[model samples]
Target: MKIGIIIPARNALPYLKEMLNSVQAQTRPAHAYIAEDRSTDDTHEWLRDHPDLYAGMRRNRRRLGWAGSLNAAAALALADGCDALFTASADDRLHPECIARCAAVLGADGGRDFVVPYAQQFGEAEHVQASLPDAGLDDLVRWPPLIDKALIRREVWEQVGGYSAKATPPGTFGTAEDWDWWIRVWKAGFTRYSVVETPLYFVRVHPGQLSDARAEHHAATVDLLAKLHPDLPWTAESRQWPPQHRTTRRQG
Candidate 1:
C-alpha cells in the first residue's frame, strides 16, 4: 500500500525539523506531505528550503485549523494515488517502524479498516498511552481510545467524508476534532480496527499547546458532540475523564 503521511502544522518551527527528520528515518518508504496553516514562524520558508524532506507541501491562505489543514493535505495525497493516509502532528515524531508496522498489519489483514499505535508523551510530560485491545463504538463515544495518529485506509476516509471542519463555537477550532472523527468512523460502520503494541508515535506535551485549549473547551465540545449525535447517550458525566483509560509514566 502507498501510505501517505499528512502533517498539519501551525507555528511549529521549533519541533518541525525533528518531526520531519523522524519521517525521513521511517523504515518503510512513505510519502510525506505538509499542510502549513498560515504559521507566523518561518515554517513556510523552512519547508521551501528543504524540498527533499517531503513529497509535497500546501500553504493555506488563512488558518484552516487542525482538521481543515488535514483535509487539504489528505486531498493532495489522495490525488497523488496514495492508498493509505496517516495524520501526524508537526510537533510529534514517529518511530522508525511506525509506517512499516501499520502497513504490514493493514496489508496482511483484509478486514481491518485502520491501525492504531501505542503512543508516548514526551517533552514537558512523559507517559505511555494505549487504546483498548478491542475498542468499539462505546469506547470511542465515551473517550477517544485511539489517537489521531493512526494509519487509515483511503476508502474509509473518503466514505467518512474526512474530518469535520466545524468547531464547537463556529469560528473557533481544534477542540475534540479527532474524537469527533473517530465517532463518525464508528457510526459509518468501519469498525474493524487493530492496535500496534509498540509505542510507535511520540506526542510532545508542553505548555500553551492546542491540548490546553481542548481542555478549556471540554464542556462546550461535549455539548456540541451531543447535539451532533443525539442518538448517542452523551451525559454530563461523559464530560469528565473516564477512569477506564489511564496513562502510565514512561519508563526510562
Candidate 2:
C-alpha cells in the first residue's frame, strides 16, 4: 500500500537529525510531510533542507499545535493519494522497519483502521519506574504507544475528520485525539492490533516529549472512552491490557 508519514514538530532542532535519519531508514519509503510549528530557532531552516531526503517532501509555515499540525499533515497525505497515513512526533525517532511493519499489519489483517506496536521512550532509562505513574493507578493515564507511527487507511481518516482543531484548556480537548479517533473507528467495527515479535517503534523521549506529560492529562481522554468507543468494555482490565489483547466488545 502507498504510505505517507506526517511529522509534527516544534523547536525540535536538537533531535531533528536523529528523526530524519530514522525516517530515511524506513524499510519501505513513504512521502514525508513535516508540519513545522513556528519555531524561534532554526527548525524551519532545518526542514528546508529535508527535501533532499525524501521525494515529494514539503514543509508548512503554520504553527498548529501538535493536534492541529498532525491533522494538517494527514490532510496533505490524503490529498497526495496515499493509501495510508503515518504519524510521528518530530522529536521522536521510529525504528527502521516501523513503517513496513505497520503497513504489513494493515494489509494482512483484513484491513484494520489502526495498527500499533510497542514503543520504549529512550533516555530517562533510570527514572522509568521511579518517575512515571501507573496507567492503572492514574485514571487519567492512557497507555503509551497508544499509536504506532501508524499507517492509517486514508478512508478511515476521512470518516473521523481527524482531530478537533478548536483550542481548549491546558488538558481539555487536546491529547488523545488519536485515541479518540481510534475508539470511533473501532466502534464502527474496525480492527486494531499490536505487533507480536518485537517493538515496531522506538520513541525518543527527553524532557519536552508529549508523552512525558501523559500523567497530567491522560484521564481527560480516558473519560471519553464511553462516547468514543460505544461498544468497547473499557474497564480496568481493558485499561490495563496485558501482553496484548484485541477485541470489538459491544458496549453496555
Candidate 3:
C-alpha cells in the first residue's frame, strides 16, 4: 500500500532533523510531506533548502494552527495518490519499522480502519504511553486512547472530512483536534481500530510543547468538545483531565 507521512510544523527547526531522520529510516519507505505553518524561525528556509527530504512541502502564508497545517500537507499527499496517510508531529520520531509494521496490519486486515502504535514520551520527561487495544468510541469519548500520529486509511480520512480546522479562542491553539477527529471517525461508523503494542512512536515532552497547552486549556477544550458532540455523554467529570498511568519510566 502506498503510504504518505504528513508532518505539521511551526518553529520546529530544532526538532526536524531527528524527526526527518526517523522518517527516512523507515523500513518500508513512504513519501514524506511537510506543512510549514509560517514559522517565525528558519523552519521554512531549512525545509526549502532540504527539498529532497520530502516528496512535497508547503509553506503557509499565515499560521494554520496544528490541524490546518496537517490538512494542508495531507491534501498534497492525497493528491499524489497515496492510499494511506500517517499524520506525525514535527517534534516526534518514529521507529524504523513503524511504517512497515502498521502498513502490514492494514494491508492484512481489511476491517481495520486505522492502526495506532504505542508511544513513549522522551525529552524532558520519559514514560511509556500505552495504546488501547481494540479501542472504540466509548474509549475515545472518555479520554484520547489513540495517539495523534496514526496510520489511517485514505478512505477513512476522506469520509471523516480530515481534521477539524475550527478556530479556537483568540490567543489559544486547538489542542484537542486529534481527539476531535478520532471521535468523528468513530461516529462515522469506522469502529474497527487496532493497536500495535510496540513503542514505535516517540513523543518529546518539554516545556511549551502542545501537551502543556492541552493541560492549560483542558476545561475549555472539554466544553468545546461537548458542544460539538452533544450526543455524547459528557459530564462534569469529563472536564477533569484524566491522569495518564505511565507503564514504564526511563531516564531522559
Candidate 4:
C-alpha cells in the first residue's frame, strides 16, 4: 500500500527541521505532505524554501485547528491515490519503521480499521505508555487508547465520514476531537489493534503545547458524545486490558 504522511503545522518553526528529518528516515519512505496553517512564525517561509522536503504542501491563509488542517491534508493524500494515510504532528518524531510496521498490521487483516502503535513520551518525563494491547468497541467508546498519530486505510476514513468539521476556531475541540473520532469508528464496528513493542512515535511534551489543553473542553464533548450515541458503553471505571497479554512484534 502507498502510505502518505500528513503533518498539520502552525508556528512549529522550532522543531520542523528535526521532524522532517525523522520523516525522511522512515524505512518504508512515505509520501509526506504538510497542511501549513497560517502561522505568525517563519513556518511558511521555511516550507516554501525547503519545498523538496514534502511530496506536496498546502498553505491555509487562516488557521483550521487540528481537525480542519488534518482533514485538508488527508483529502490531498486520498486524492493523490494513496492507499493509506498516516498523520504526524510537526512537533513529534517517528521511528524509521513506523509506517512499514503499521502498514503490515492493517494489510494483514483487512477487517481491522486502524493500528494503534505504542508512543514514548519525552522532554517532560521519559516513559513509554503502551496502548491497551487490544481494544474493542467498549474501549473506544470510553477513551481513545491510541495516540493521535496513526496509519489508517482510506476505507476507514470513508466509513467514519472524516474528522469533525469545526467551524468555530482552532483548538476549540481540544483533545476531545480524537476521542470523538474513535467513538464513531467503534460505533461503525471497526476494531483497533495495539502494536505492543518499542515506541513507534516519540511524543514531545513541553510548556504551552496544545495537547496539554486536551481537558479544556473535554467534559462538554464527552457529554455531547453520550447524548449522540446513547448505547455506547459509558463507564466510570477503566476498561483497559493489561498490555502483558500481547505477543506481536515488528518483523523485518
User: What is the TM-score of each predicted model, taking all chains together?
Assistant: 0.92, 0.72, 0.91, 0.83
What stretches of model 3 exceed 4 Å from their correct place?
167-170, 208-215, 243-252
Give a tens-digit lDDT track for model 3, residues 230-252.
88887766766543322232211
lDDT of 2 by residue, 87-116 (tens): 777777778888877777777746666565
- Using TM-score as the measure, name the better of candidate 1 and candidate 2: 1
Q: What 10-residue stretch in candidate 1 is worst by lDDT?
A: 243-252
Give lDDT per model, in order.
0.81, 0.59, 0.81, 0.71
**lDDT per residue as tens, model 1, 172-234:** 757568878988998999888898889999989876552454544666677788888788887
Q: Candidate 4's residue-wise lDDT over 124-165, tens digit each?
A: 655675666566666655456655667887888878877885
Worst 10 residues of 4 by lDDT: 243-252
Which lDDT value does model 2 have at 99? 84
lDDT of 2: 0.59
Deviating ranges (above 4 Å) for candidate 4: 109-111, 166-173, 192-194, 208-216, 233-252
Misplaced by over 4 Å in model 2 are: 54-62, 126-145, 166-168, 171-174, 192-197, 208-216, 219-252
TM-score, candidate number 1 = 0.92
Alpha carbon lDDT of residue 138, candidate 1?
Answer: 69
